[model samples]
Target chain A: MKETSLQNGLVERYIREVGRRLPQKQRDDVETELRSLILDALEARGDAVVDETPEEAQVAVLKELGAPEEVAGRYAAAPRYVIGPRLYDAYVRVVGIVLGAVALALVISTVINLFQTQPEGISILVTVGEFILQYISAAASALGFTTIIFVVLERTLSEEDLKDLKDETEWDPRTLPHVEDHDRIQPVGMVVNICLTILAIVLFNLFVDRLGIVFMQTEEGWRTIPMLSETALKTYLPLWNISWVMALALNIAVLQQRRWSTATRILELGVKVFTIYVLARMLAGPVPWLPFSSWAGDGMQIVESLLTQVFRWAMVFGIIGTVVEIGQSIYRMIRQR
Target chain B: MDEIINNLILELRRGTLMLSVLSQLRERQYGYSLKERLAEQGMDIDQGTLYPLLRRLEKQGLLSSEWDVSEARPRRYYVLSASGQEVLAAMITEWQQLVKVMEHLLPQA
Candidate 1:
């Protein structure tokens, strides 16, 4: 509340009520404007506040001005909701899933602990209760953090960032993602998926030799083993690098498509088939993976034997993975109809 | 029926209220004086609505405001921005077209 000799107590209270609802930065200015407006009216009434004030006149003025909340409501830039109304449903879903996961983990841990420790039932119950409290607080903290993030984004978003939100605005067809619909292409989710794919490529290309069993480690350095054969890598390096680049381009195309159409699905299927083709060729002869020389000193037979086993497992896994993925792709195409 | 008409009438006036406030602020006037100026021109603007509308216009870069404590009872005076003059001119032309169109559409007295 802000006022001078011109503004009366009643108007000050009204301004205070209205000021509390306004943004912190605008509150003082809003209060000042409200006080000045009301005072001007009161001054017109001739010593209504500073002198013997007429209750009827003050009541009439306040009545005409309307309720403080109603007045304050007009000044609000956006309505307040739990994490704001636009993101409310998504927030609820995320919170519900997290809480559900916590509950499931709690149940599993309780069951496992009871069987393993064979603890007293009362103590177990007490521990479970404590765990439940902790879970509830964790879920609440997660919700609070999500709400803060969304609120900040809601307030700070530029006109361009809000382009996706406009009902009538036309999105650039070229920049569309591989997923269709607002839910399917959930902007953040699609970006994250693309980022993860890039990360996988980087990790594999950079750390190709240091991917398997660690042996003889004591702070300084360990003899790190390679799972994939360097010879195989050298053989496939050209094709592998080309395929990686092509796959990255496909992912980029999907991002541009913005929706999973037949084009994206076909592209994905082609990439999968290409991968399976490479793997099948590798399986026919030698898989790049074998036990290192350090692991088996001149044990060529041991290396060959282990390599066969690794090759068999890869074939099985590869076939199953491809079949499932191709099946999913076909299913998605059919379902689109 | 009367309530519905009243609500509709309020909606009709709401758009003009900003224009009315802007027009009055062409000359520097504090909150009350601005209201009084509008009232003189036959628009009984609400203080709550007028003050917020002034602030909103200021935010939109249409009106500029300053606080003056020179006299008893410090007051914030508002004046139209340079951009506001340009917008007001365009809006006046648009408003005239709207009035002409409405007059044609509306049932004759």
Candidate 2:
């Protein structure tokens, strides 16, 4: 083999470089093994040409062995992928979308607030600063919440669960339905409807003056009157409130389910039936649908009867329609099965 | 295209690399000799990959190693442990089953 100083120095330098990177316990054994390997390759006849100098052959052998650090790296334990490679992209995307959504909401609120109030220079600056602070805080909290969820999932979920998650993401063409535009749930529309429904509930229950009609001035700016009678409201408001909340729960379930599943359909049907029941009860009870003055007498009585009949028929129609929908859903589910 | 194929090839070979090495490690062999033996059998393992893989297998108690300074050039020779032999046998059966499946699906041109 090469007894040359050049070859010896090169081997020592390479081994030392690798040894430096390796953990202390593994260092000696790995270094010894490497040195023997390098020397064995140098000694092997076919590996080194007879014409080449010992140093040249040693250099060639070292090159063939690849980088010293690279050789050491293979022995090291693989990177601690806490979230794993498969889930990392999804984690990033979820965090980004959640945080971005928070930021967007903050931006929208700031813009709405700006429109409401005329901003003098210092006041505008202060408002912008406040918006930025709120934006960062909300975004940070959202990101933190999402990250904790993912980390917990990563730690707690079994390999099978993780594999199932991976399969869900991969999305096979064979698994997809034949229908085009497969995503049937209108998430954006549902969100807008949910928000509007919430606003309605809030106004009806809390800010009744903001809702209904505004009458003429009564020496206190303008007089606003409640559309429904107090007795009617007392009787029906609680029932209607419960119905609204149930409707909200139903929509949220729909939004989460994303498509029309049997469970969600049943929930929708239940909410609809419950709502119609409440409406029917309200119609039958002492609360008048429209508040009217007793001075109108016969005219008021006729109008009241007409409205009552209209409401009863509407309730009946709603019940029938909902029942038909439930029947249709059941039929569809049976066909699918 | 080349990089894709290269990566594909590396991935395909990754699991079998350990199996192939363990098969030859039934007999005591030093790092360079083991590399040469694998090459002779058409398993073109990188030398950098081999040396560390041997240490890893040893660390996992699949292989046992001893330094023989009795020879002119002191060599750390490695041989398969009892556990390693059992693992290797199981791996071989799995590999044979995989080959049969592959042969059935991947017909020759």
Candidate 3:
């Protein structure tokens, strides 16, 4: 039977509308499927059946099935992982590396702290050093726990039947809708990071001043002062903290972009590691000045001991923070992929 | 009596529509031929509905289709994909069990 212009127009329009929503790889497949359905309906009604025009019948069938948009949506309703599988696998591998590094740092620092001693029978430096080591240990344990939970949830809760559906839905780079400038959330994330970093710095300074006398009585004495020095503070404190703030901002930007890339995700991770390193150096007293040698007189030995222990603990915290941050970044990157 | 019998038949077939479609698709058939065959078997499905269902099943990886353009008129022929075959095998096992249960429950013929 000769196809009428009206019937042809209806089929063409329907196919085009539906096809536009589908990925190019699957577009032809969907069109063929849709065409067969229309033809099948016409054939079932019979070639000689003349109650309704082909155009009218086609339109009626399309209407009952709903709009092309709605029909397309049903076929495309497959679940999307926030982090693609490849990224998730990468994240797990990277996090494992981070956790291992942190654990090693913790063990090494703990052993070193055990051997180090103070002049006075009970030195506050050792106490502080022990406290920081404990803190790192605790933080690492918490992160390890959380990662395990999330991984378990990902494996157990994910739908097994929808595996193919997940694979079929390709991440089309072109069709990824452009994010509007105003909709960007990076600025907000950076602002929050800066605010938090500032708060942390202020707290660190206050803690140092409160414990200044004790630090001075230790073997390393003036070395602990760099942790509170405004210049060293500015140099070391903000590096990774700023990077963290920026990483968070970039993550927000990525979210706004609506398309995930491994490059942006890795950059975000790099910033997180840099931030942790900066914080570690700040806590350990920036190396160039040899801040430990300046303290003098009768209390030099005590001050030296105190500063040494404090620096050691700071190193421990820094090491732990670096690992945790790396783990977090790797997890997020993999999850996003 | 005829109306009641028809409605019961529909309900019975409705539950087994997917299985019926899979069973028939052991041999390759296009959308039009599939609908005709089903109609001949007394399950008269609307073309609009069957086609979409077939597409959905194909998308789900239960069926696969390819166009046969060697003939003057090109037709899209669908058959059970590997995954579809596996699912069908499982479904048949369940169906046999169901049939045995029904046979035991029904009054002696």
Candidate 4:
């Protein structure tokens, strides 16, 4: 009787291990069927004798059936990989492009800082080390974020959407963009836009100190004057971050769909309006330029005034450009309808 | 060379394994009884592979199963569905044509 109980305990443990991995809907049925099958196999092996089946015989039968995980894996409904074959190509391309953009941005920022600081000897090496560390962290996070987007896409994209992506027979030449079609999403342009937007986000959020006009000064060597007043930047950084992130998300959506739709165009219109509001507020708020009078004495007074003029003109042009973009978006949306 | 041939053989058999399992389910059979029946006919399959495949086939609507509790221990019996019979018939016709094609294509042993 004790031996029989021991044999049943071994079988019960194995069943539990497999059932724990199976989906809830199938777990009970699979466990019941598996128990019956195991007992049947044991009987065939002459180990199901009422009170005498040895524990070793039970183990042997279970081993032949295979490991619990392997058995459960065969029963899994979902594919094992986070990003399956359907989205694999897009995932790889997006990660490569984003990581490349991040590395490029880091190198550009480091070069700009190097020129501004005129770092000598050990300082130059320290700057390069910092650049390397920043690139590693940026690239890692970019890969992670891109993977998460693809994982979400893998789960959410319907079969029809995937088929549209891959099936060459489904292609219709009539659907191709005309020569003057402004709504046709240019892949190369989208990539460049995404890269630039990401670079802006990284620079504004992380390396705001490096945004400045570099000037040569006699006797004092290279003088780095930090542009953009600290109070203004601190007030507006969150808004800028939100706008850039929204732009990044919109660009990714267009890239995935391979063309601009009415929905995305409407989204673009909304984003541009938000951006205009932020720019208008910044212009109306305190002067964003950092004047050099306190640090540079009376000799640099003219340079400070020239910098102020340049900053105001740049803001004016930025607002004008965004307004023109918003007009284009509305035109496209109306025409597309 | 032997390993390569073994793999090639395995690949060839993998497709036909589903047909072989389906053909036997014209009548109802419990899991072990079905496994033993196939083994008797010289088509030995692992319990691990056969059992999950049975569940998958049922999920695909090719087979229907029921639990018979009248026995000493309950056994789940699987039989061919109506659509399963249609698929089996079509598959048999395709297999026969494939066999004829192979016979003509291959040099006489």
Candidate 5:
């Protein structure tokens, strides 16, 4: 009897610990159920004599029962979320779409500036385009950020109502499903598509007109006709034009295939650095040897300076955005593991 | 194996816990004593799990508890509220029907 009492006491303490984490309303029922389970487990062991030392029995019972935290976690419902699983996934999807759209818009406006004949007009266009791109990107990011806040709030509120629901639903361990190996192809495919589209646009602008595609011009420099200006096409061009696309694509592909291997990540960083260098070169073009001649000859010097400044700022922002996205992807990969 | 037994036990608990708890509270009993009594009936309940259920039922106005300081060990005694009694009656009826259905399916010894 003394041995039984000791075993019972250990069981009681175990139950109490598990109960403390549970909501106040469902505490009693869950406690009762868990206590019965402990008793059942003890009975099944069947090793101890009735008169054995209580402490010894308790030690035996507890060892067999497993850790209190692990057992309690088993009984807990799938963890309540502020945003439900469905909503969280939806939120991520919507945010991705919004960012993609904003990027596309910025790319389109940049391409338009490249085509304008009037130097003064080009300067104004670049400034206006830069302002619009900044505003839209900020708005989209803010919208995405709000989804996280909403998820947190929803979880807190729902937890209150769900406290009493403990015994109604059977506890099942929640496990994230294994991500298939094939899923690695998605980011790689997106990167490749983006890069190819950009290259195609640049090549089309550069070679298409000389080859007789009327709207495209390659004579002085690669430029596209204003009428052919579409947001998707423009955004695709400047975005994929830089070396970052190759680096980002390779990194994402390697990261996906190899998980968090240090060598792959280092290579990714190298590619990013090289891409930045290329971007800087594109932003800061060759300095004019004869500024006065160019300024007086066609009055295009002022226009060129303004366009260069706008492009420089855009490239700087693009680099910042790319770095941020890379950092986020790396963090996500680690966390997902 | 233990896994199968645990799953079966968990399912049984999910279906009948509310009724078992409600029936026990028809008479006034404090949390600790109620748990002890249930254990004697081979339904050992952990205090960790029980306290929360009691509070929830109380919040829902299904059960009422009051601090009883009559004994040296002053404790809170809980009794079934009218609404709780009604719910318990409904749950008991549903359980009886379920038992009857299962009994019909089982072969007699």
Candidate 6:
């Protein structure tokens, strides 16, 4: 009885492996059929007992049937891939560009850090170690995000649309665009926006304290001055979160559609409007700064006022940028009509 | 050269597999029995390929199946549907013509 149960267990485990890979709807039916077929195959061997087949014999039979994934692939009607051939080229290109950009940024930042701090000996080794760690994390994140975007594209893009993209005869070089076509959607740029928006959402919501200017001093070591007013952040965070999330969805939509449509343009306008509201609220309210009494010293007041002035100018520029975006969205909508 | 020949052979057999499967399903047989029957007739097909092909053909309405719970293990039996017979007849005619063409085109081996 124990031997029979053990043999059945082995068979059941193999069936479950194959069923896991199959779609939910077909899973039960396939598993039932597979169980029956496997038992029949085992029975076909003359020396095999009816119920108590040896482990070696069962293993041989299952091995002959093939690996669970291979068997499941044969069962599945649809082509299986995380990112299919249709989007594979674009996926590779985007990953290459992102990693390259990440490498370049790391090199540039490291150069700037070295110049600013002028680290020596052990500190120089520490800098190099930091660069290596940053590069690895950044490259990994870039690859992860790029792959996720391509996987989404693969799922959302219809076979007909992908075929149309590949149809070179339909795409003429002359008809591509004369000047900088504002109607054209850039996929890489949208992906970058998505990554940055995600990072911003995480930073502003979870790690708000990290957003500040850091000062490196020999006497007191590193000190950071908090830039955002607690009251301002509390009032405007919800609005900021909403706009960021909306922008993320809009960028993904544009990436999928591969063009700027009237609908997306309208959505973009809505997000910009929200951003403008947030910016306007910040500008009208108290200066977005915490108390500067934490680390007071010589030239501290000058630095504080200068930073406040910079924040005001930044808010002004932000509002202007948002207004320009709204104008562009409206112009596109009209032109589309 | 051997690999190329093997690949060509596989490609040649790919279409014929469906026809062979369809021809066998004229009578009711369960998955294992059908696999055994095909292998006996010198067409060796693995269980993985054969089982999925049966399900696909059944899905396409060329074959119909039912579970026979009377057996110790409930076995799903498959047979040609009305449309399946008609398709098989048409496919046989096409196959004969193709064989004739091939015989004429190929050098005497």
Model 1: per-residue lDDT, tens digit, A1-337?
A: 1234425556667778888988898899788767767756766765534454455555667777789888888788765443566666666777687778777776577555645554332553455576668778877876677778777776776667766665675678887667545215555766776687677677668877668878678778897766677777777766666667667777677678776667777887888888887666555545566555645667576556544554544564586589788988788678767
Please give, for residues B52-92, the per-residue lDDT of candidate 4 as tens digits.
99999998899999999998778999999999999999999
Interface RMSD of each: 1.3, 0.9, 3.6, 0.6, 8.7, 0.8
Could you tell which candidate, 3 or 6, scores higher by lDDT?
6
Off by over 4 Å in 3: A4-8, A43-48, A64-66, A80-337, B1-15, B44-49, B52-62, B81-83, B102-109
TM-score against native, each model: 0.48, 0.52, 0.37, 0.58, 0.42, 0.47
lDDT of 6 by residue, A1-337 (tens): 2225744477889999999999999999999999888888877753544555466667877888888999999898666789887688888888899999999998788866765575533564567678879999999998998888887787788778887778566566888656777779778888999999999999999999978888665577767667777897888889788988999999999999998877888888888898888887766566656756555655587577556544554665688778987887787677767
- The A-chain TM-scores of all the candidates are 0.37, 0.42, 0.30, 0.45, 0.39, 0.43
Residue A201 deviation, candidate 4, in Å? 44
Off by over 4 Å in 6: A1-10, A47-60, A77-80, A93-140, A153-337, B1-8, B57-64, B79-97
Query: Per-residue lDDT tens digits of candidate 2, residues A1-337?
Result: 5445634488888888888988888889788788888888887843546788776776888888888778778876543445776568899999889988897798678766755564433564577578879988888888888988887776677768867776466667898767743326889988997998899799878886565467678776877665666677778788878888887887898898787677776677787778767855754565444546543446586566556544544554565566676677667667767
Q: Is candidate 3 or candidate 4 better by TM-score?
A: 4
At residue A80, give the lDDT of candidate 3: 38
Question: Which of 1 and 4 is the better model by TM-score?
Answer: 4
DockQ score of each predicted structure, in the order shown: 0.50, 0.69, 0.16, 0.57, 0.07, 0.55
Q: Mark the regions of model 5 whose C-alpha exceeds 4 Å error after superposition.
A: A1-298, A313-337, B1-8, B11-15, B97-109
Write out fnat for all predictions, comma-separated: 0.62, 0.86, 0.28, 0.66, 0.00, 0.62
Task: Locate the minimum summed-lDDT window of 10 residues in model 6 chain A.
Answer: A1-10
- Give the candidate order by descending DockQ: 2, 4, 6, 1, 3, 5
Name model 1 segments beyond 4 Å from true.
Answer: A1-8, A47-52, A76-149, A164-337
- Model 1: how far is B36 from its true place, Å? 2.0
lDDT by residue (tens digit), candidate 3, A1-337? 3444535577778878888877677788778767656655655554656788766777776675568776665555343344446347655766677666666676676556555643222443455566567757765785677577655555555465436335677688999787654323465665676567666656654553443333445564453343244566457645644654576566566766655466665676666667666655655455322344454455566565666555655565666777886786677666655
Each model's lDDT comes to 0.72, 0.77, 0.66, 0.83, 0.61, 0.82
- lDDT tens digits, residues A210-285, model 5? 3322344577876533322244334444544544456546646664674545456556666676666655554554
CAPRI classification of candidate 2: medium
Model 5: CAPRI class: incorrect
Q: Name the lDDT value of residue A227 in candidate 3.
A: 28
Please say which candidate is ahead in TM-score: 4 or 6. 4
